[model samples]
Target: MMPLSMVASGETVRLIAVRGGRGICFRLAELGLVPGATFQVIQGSGQGPLILAFGETRLALGRGMAHKIYVESFMRGGQECQNN
Candidate 1:
């Protein structure tokens, strides 16, 4: 899994894990960032806050916060990338 900040814009990813303290996890969970949640990266340029789209909802997360969240990027059709 890679940090959410590393994902490129327009890429869809599934949340794998959130690394941090309980407070951080709770905050992310409140924002609907729980594990297994699938969302698209609206903006993740590795600079500034990363914007994520969850269906009709969009959330702007700081780079630090994004770094704490790990996700697996999808290739297409919501399929997970296979290691080669």
Candidate 2:
């Protein structure tokens, strides 16, 4: 799995695992970032916060927080790949 921070804008990815303390994990879960959740990266790249869209909700995540979340990216052509 790859860190969420590595994903590019417009890419859709499924939440894999989170790497951090319990508090952080709980907070992320509260924001709908639990494993198996699929979301699109609306804004990423550079050092700014990432804008993620899932359903009708959008979450702006900082680089540090993004790095703590791992995800599986679904590539084009119906192929799923893990980039770590």
lDDT of candidates 1 onward, in order:
0.82, 0.82
Off by over 4 Å in 1: 76-84
* Worst 10-residue lDDT window, candidate 2: 75-84
Instruction: Tell me which residue pairs clash in candidate 1.
Output: none
User: Model 2: per-residue lDDT, tens digit, 1-84?
Assistant: 678999988999888778889998899889887777889999987788999999899998889989988887755322343322
Clashing pairs in 2: none
Task: Give the per-residue lDDT digits (tens) of candidate 1, residues 1-84.
Answer: 788889999999888788889998889889787777899999987689988899799998899988888888755334443321
Q: List, in order, the clash count of every candidate structure.
A: 0, 0
Model 2 stretches astray by more than 4 angstroms: 75-84
> RMSD to native for every prediction?
4.5, 3.7
